[model samples]
Target: MKKKNKKLEVRKPNQEVRLASNVYIILIISFYSMIGIMTLCSLMLLIGIIAFKTNNLPLFSQIKTVISTIMIIIVLMFLILYPIKNTIEPETKLEKDAFIFALNRLGLKSKCELEKLNGIIHNLKRDRLHFSSESDLYRIYLLLENGQMVDYLISLRDLKQLIKIGQKVKIRNSNLKLPISGWCSDHLSISVIDEEGKTFYKFESYEPFNNKTKLKGRKIVG
Candidate 1:
C-alpha cells in the first residue's frame, strides 16, 4: 500500500494549460454576453417609456435621471467586478507544484544544462482529437542532435515551437523553487518563443523515446 501510494503520477502540462485557457475564454464570453443582453433590454424599456411620456416635464426628467443612474451603476459594476472576475486562480498551480516535487527526486544534473540551447526536432507526432474535450493537439517528439535522437520526449504548447523537422529551436531558461528540497530547489524551467513571437511553456513530464514502432506509427505521412 505504501509503495502504491508513493507512485508519482505523470501528467501532461500543455493539456492543463490548454484547458485552463479555454475555460477562461468561455467565462469571459459568457459574462460579456449576459451583460450585453441585460443592457439592451433595459435600454429598450427606457426608450419606450420616454417615448410615451414625452410631454410630461417631471416624468421626462425622472426617466432621464434613472437612465443616467443606471448607466453609472453599470460602469461602476464593470470597474469593480471585472478585475475580480479576471483574477481567477491558476487551474494548474497544484499540478505544477507536484511536478516540482518529482523533479527534486530526479536530481539536478551537475553539468546537465537543460536551460538554453538550439536544437532540431527529428520525429514529431501530434494528435488533437485523441481526446474529444481537449483544445490543442497532443504533441510528443524528441530533440535531435547531429541526426541522433535525444533520449527524452520534448513537449511545448504549439507546432511553431518545432515548425520544420530540421528547424532550429532557441531555448531559454527559467527557475522555480519548490517544496521538495525544503521548498528551495531551483529546477530548470523553460518557455519557447517561436519566430512569430508567440510563447509556449515547457510541459511537466518527460518520457523515454523507447518505443520505436509506436513512434513510427504516430508520424505524419507526407
Candidate 2:
C-alpha cells in the first residue's frame, strides 16, 4: 500500500501587516512629540493672554496689532524653545567645565585636543550625539589600545554601555580574573573595572548628575 504524503505549509509574516505596524509606531511617537510641543505653546499663549487681560493694558485695547504681535511672539518662543531647553540644556557650560575638570584629573585629553572626534554610530550622522531617549544610549563608542574603535552596543545592558562617545572613560583594570570556585565557578572570565570600582550604571539605575557627584571624562591609554 502506498503511504499518503502530508503537505507542510509555511506561514510568513504579511508585508502589509509589518508595514502597518511600523507606521503605527511612527505615528504614535510623532503624535506624542507634536502634542507635547503644541500643549506647551498653547499654555504659554493662554497665560500671556490671561495676564494681559487681567492687567487691562490700554495697548491691548487700542492697538490690537500690538497684542496680536505679542501673542505670536510668546507662542513662537514657547514652541521653539521648550524642546531645545529640555533636550540640550544638560550639556551646558557648567557640564562642559565639569567634564574638562574630570578629564584633566584623569590625564586624558579633551575632545577638542583629540585628532578625530566623531559619532560612534554611523546612523547618528552627528559629530556630537544627543541622547534624549533610553534606546539612543547604546550608540556610544570608544577607542581601543590597538588603534581600533569599539562600540558600546556589543552588550546592550552591560557596564560598558554606560560610556558615551566623546566622554572620557578611565579603565582601571581590564583583565580582572574570575576564580573557579564558589558562586562564580566553572567559568573563566575577565572583568573590566571602573576607576572607582563601581559597575557601569544600568539604564534603570542611572541618575542625572547633580551638584554632589560630577560627571567626569576619562579614556584608557595603554
Candidate 3:
C-alpha cells in the first residue's frame, strides 16, 4: 500500500467581502483621526486664549499648573493620533487584512516544492514584506501603484528545499508569489523558522531589505 500525495494549498475567503470590510475599516479610522485633529486644535486655541488673557505673572505654582494642563492635553491627543500611535489599531489590522485579501485574490495556491516558492519570492520586486503572526501562516511582499498594489506569499517548508539568491530559475505558475521591487539589504542575513509548523529550516537572503515598506513610496525603518 502507498500513501497518497497531498497537494499543499493556500486558500482564502471571498475577496469582495474582504475588500468591503477594508474600506469600512479605513473610513472608520479616518473619522477618528479627524476627530483627534479637531480636538487637538480646540485645545491649542484654548491654551492660546488663556495665555493671551494673562494679566500678571503670579506664583510659580500657577505656572506649573498651567504647564501640567498643557502636557496632559497633549498626551491625551497622542492617544488617538494615528501617525505616532504605537498601539494596535483598527486601521493597522485593516492594512494586514487587505494584504491578505490581495494575496488570495492574486490566486496563490502552490502544490509545488519549497524551491519553487523561494523562486517566486525572488522574482516579484516587492517594495515591502508583509508577514502575519496572527491567523494565516504566510509571507506576502508588495508594491503600490495607482492606488492599487501587487503582492505574493511564501508557504513552503521542506528541509531539502533551499534556493540561493540570484539563482537562475524558469518561472511557471503565474500564481506564484515573489518580491522583486523591494530595496536590497545591506548585509547577508539568514532566518530559521519552524518547517510546516514543526521542524525548522534555516535560510538566508543576500543583501535583503530590512525595513517596513510604508505606503506612498517611502521606506520607514522598523
Cα lDDT listed for each candidate: 0.41, 0.35, 0.36
Q: Which candidate tops TM-score?
A: 3
The lDDT of model 2 is: 0.35
Tell me which of candidates 1 and 2 scores higher on TM-score. Answer: 1
List runs of model 3 lying over 4 Å from the truth: 1-41, 48-62, 81-156, 159-222
Which structure is stronger by lDDT: 2 or 3?
3
Q: What tens digits encode model 1's per-residue C-alpha lDDT throughout 1-67? A: 0011122323454555445545444544455566677678767766665666554668668778677
lDDT by residue (1-222, candidate 3, tens digit) is 111222323245456547654553454456456677768786886577467644365667557757776787677665655443322122233333343343344443222212112222233232224654523223333222222333333333331144233332221111212211112222221232233322133332212223342211111222
Candidates 1 and 3 compared by TM-score, better number: 3
Task: Give lDDT for model 1.
Answer: 0.41
Candidate 1 residue-wise lDDT at 107: 45
Off by over 4 Å in 2: 1-16, 52-56, 59-222
Ranking by lDDT: 1, 3, 2
Clashing pairs in 1: 179-183
The CA lDDT at 186 in model 1 is: 24
* Per-prediction tally of clashes: 1, 3, 13
**Runs off by more than 4 Å, candidate 1:** 1-13, 59-69, 72-84, 87-222
TM-score of each: 0.29, 0.21, 0.30
User: TM-score of predicted model 3?
Assistant: 0.30
